[model samples]
Structure formats: structure tokens, C-alpha cells
Target: MSSAPVIGVAVLLVKGETVLLGRRRSSVGHNTYALPGGHLEFGESFEECAVREVKEETGLDIKDIEFVTVTNDVFTEAAKPLHLVAVFMRAHLADPDQLPQNMEPEKCYGWDWYNWKNLPQPLFRPLETMLKNGFSPFSTELN
Candidate 1:
């Protein structure tokens, strides 16, 4: 019998017209740009997972974490099939003055702020799913 898919939480840290992203250097999405996130630990709430992952991967604290959407992410691993339930979320820096740094050099290149309209190419599968679905959490048109 196949096991259930694992849960991964992605947090989009918003700052004005930009959001934080990192270039993945590890397996699953190597060389692709993606939001800071990781597998959800057992008993961890989505918001808590978001906060923890953001800090773990970016050396940044994020607040205002909110659920946005979910994606059924399917990919390959070691020539085997893999599946994951990706939970998307939006958040803001808990300390606005704190800048993001590359906390895990093994997993990511570094963190950088990019405008929503001009995001870095080759997004992770879950993030690309959000884009193809027309989901925009950080719209600049907040009037």
C-alpha cells in the first residue's frame, strides 16, 4: 500500500511590492526559485510551520501568517515517484528591519526580494501551480 503524501508549507513574505524567494540548491527543485518553506513537522499548525520554516531557511522572522491555498504537488525522486500536499501561505516579517540571509547554504543559494510582476524564472512546482491557477496574494493594487 502506498503511504499518504507528506505536507509541506510555503510562506511568502511580503514587503511592499516585493516578496522573498530563494534559489534551491538541493534535490526536488534544484536550481529553481521558490518561497522559503519545508516539510511540516508532526503536530505543527500551518501558521506555526510557516513561521518556523521562514526562520529555518531564511534567518528571518515572519508574522501575519495566513493560509492562502493548497496544491497537489507531484514530482520525481531518485527515479521514483513522489507526491506532496503543499500548503501555501502569506506572511510578513516580524521585524521589518531584519533582512533575509542564506541560512542553509546546502539547500538554497540565498534570499532576495523580487517584485511580484518580475519574479525569478523557473519556480518550484508548487509555486508554479499557484501562478498557473491565477492566485495572487501580493497584489500591488491595494487601493
Candidate 2:
């Protein structure tokens, strides 16, 4: 049996005490908060895809990135079994003040900075864990 392959990239973008998050538009649980990222296109490396996705979804340029964790999850969406390979990375913005003007209006409803200590409930689970644990992807424990 052949399974459909999907590549997802997520960024843990931090600026001092806050982290950047975007609301997913078409997820099973709509209005869920997640890090800025998306799938990798053909001929693109994961790192390049990560940088591009952050810019496309959040209008921010990233640098000095470090690989975090990788996960594989199988779930059903829209009545279809979906298999995903998710890659998480840590990145820093050159200038947080600069916003990109070309974000998709529907896909990205809005952006916000949340204190690492206090995050809203029902955040994208993995992202929340990353924030609460202080950005160490290599560590196994959630500290």
C-alpha cells in the first residue's frame, strides 16, 4: 500500500518574552493557533522551505536557525487518512517590526505575540510545549 506523503515545517520564532503565532484557516480545528510554517515544495530543502514559509505566512525574515524535533503523525482529515512528516525549527527575526504586506488574507487571519509564560488554551499542542519548555528541541523532557 502506498501512503500519501506530506511535509510540514513549523517555526518557533521568538523575540524576547514573546513568540509569534498564526491561526490556521483550514485545519480540522479551525481557529487553532500554530507557529508560522507550511509544506515544502519540490526542489526545496527543509531549511529553505522553513525560511520561505515563515516569510509567506508571517511576513518575517528568519536567520540563525537550529533544528528542533521531527515527528510523524497519522490522522484523518476531511474523511481522508493523512500522513505527515513535521519538522520544527528555531529562528530569530532580523527586525520584528517589519511586516510583510503579501500575506494571504484568509489563511492568516492575524498575528500575535504571546508571553512564553502565559499562553492561551488550545494552542497548537507541540508549539505550546516548545514555548513552555524554553526552546530546546534536543531535550527530551518538557522542563
Candidate 3:
């Protein structure tokens, strides 16, 4: 609906060989698996946004947040045509033994850790695009 593309911060919260994700309950990507993130707030740095979003959505704190990559996604087939510039970031769990909880039930079904080699079905657009382009959060080299 908006004329300009919205900026989204997607955190690849890693733990060993797995990453945290949640099934979206929102209209934009309903039923799709996605990372813990949201729109980048005005004047907020990428790291701050990633940290805040993860805690707000998953009730898990993250650390070592670093920029990974970006994806320019345009969902023309969606019910409402949409464009998004997704900024991907990599991070690790602040507490290694801490489990993730569904902090925002209204927006996400729940959070879980899935192996990077085998992800859940029906991934969110930006995530899918990133995978298609071979962007791996576990790797140090940027793609």
C-alpha cells in the first residue's frame, strides 16, 4: 500500500548448528516461518533493532549481532502488493541454555530452533530469497 519500500531487520539468531524462527501470524506472511525481527524503527541502529526485536518477539536475548546481508523482496503476488528491503543480521543466544518462548502470541505462533541444513517449510519471502542466494548465517563469509 505504501509507495516506498519498508526496511525490515531480520536476525539470524544462531545456536550451534541451529537458528531460531517463528511461524508468523500476521497477514503479511501468515503461516510462514521467519526470523525474529520487525521493521527498523526510525533513527535506530541495525544492531539495536535486532536485539530489541528478538527479545520482544522471542523472549530471548541475543549477542554478537553483526550485519550479514540484505535482500530486496517484492511480493507482487501477495494479496496486497508489497515491497521490502530486508537487512539480515547474525547473532548468538546470550544465554546458551536459555530456551525461547513465544513472547508475542498475537504476531507469531511460537519460536523454535531448526537446523540450518534443514529449514521449515513455507519460509517467509525475505528468508527464502536469502537461502536461494546461498546466504548462510553460520558462515563467517558474506554472500
Candidate 4:
């Protein structure tokens, strides 16, 4: 038997002082806040997938993507194993005036921009750490 294939993508979209976050509406961790992203389709490159997912979920066009970190989340949901490889990327919006449009009404409740100094409670740990620690734009990637 073969191991499950690596899939999924996550993005860290930043403006000057705020980061974008979305409230998930589906999956095992529904209603939780997560970075904007989703699964990669066949024949799509990671970068292309990232752009597509971000647009589809958040309705924002990402420009100049810089690779960041990788997160592997595997857990038992209802006694079945779920494996995900999340490719985290740092991207800037083409137009800061634009706002996130909730396309998947049932899958994502809403979107918000939180200041780096005042992030909401119960945030996704890794993303919180990234904000608190001050990610360097000059850096290529994070381990």
C-alpha cells in the first residue's frame, strides 16, 4: 500500500499592519480561524495552486508570492486518518483597497484583518508565532 499523497496549501497575506484570517466552516476543524488556502488540483504547480486557492477562498489576487514555511497536519477525525501537507506562502495583495469576498458561504463564515500587535485570541499557533516573532520579508523561507 502507498502512503497518502501530499496536498493542500496555506497563505499568509499581509498588508502593512494587518494579516488576513478566515473562519473555516467545514472539515473536522470547522469554525476555526485559519490562513486562507485550500487543496491543490492535479497538474497544478504549488505556486499556481496557492494563487488559485487564495483567490477562490478570499477573493483576493495575490501578487509576488514568497515561499515561507511548511506544515504537516495529520490527525484522526472520526477514527479515520487525515493527512495534509500545507505549503505556506507570504503574498501581497495587488490592490489593498479590495476586501475578501466570502465565496463559500457554508465553508467560510467571514474574513477579518487583524493588527500584528493585537491578534485575536485562540489563533492558529504557528501563524500566531509567525506574527509575534516578526517574520522577515528578506528571508526566503522558514523551517
Best by the TM-score measure: 3
Over 40-77, each residue of candidate 4 has an lDDT whose tens digit, in order, gives 88998778987998888878898888778666666455
Residue 89 of model 4: what lDDT? 80
Q: In order, how many clashes per candidate?
A: 0, 0, 0, 0
> What is the lDDT of every predicted structure here?
0.87, 0.71, 0.92, 0.73
Tens-place lDDT digits, model 3, residues 1-143: 66999999999998889998899998788999999999999999999999999989988888999999999998887788889999999999888988899989999999999999999999999999999998888775777
Model 1, span 55-118: residue lDDT tens: 8888898888888889997786624566879998899988889999898999999999999999
TM-score of each: 0.91, 0.78, 0.96, 0.80
Ordered by TM-score, highest first, the candidates read 3, 1, 4, 2
RMSD of each: 2.7, 3.7, 1.0, 3.3
Best by lDDT: 3
Candidate 4 runs further than 4 Å off: 1-6, 124-143
Candidate 2 lDDT tens digits, 1-143: 22776888888787777677767676543677877888889998878988998887777888978777766666565356567667888778877676644387688667877776776667765565555556553344533
lDDT of 4: 0.73
- The better-scoring model by lDDT among 1 and 4 is 1
Clashing pairs in 1: none
Task: Report how far off residue 124 is in candidate 1 (Å).
Answer: 0.4
lDDT of 3: 0.92
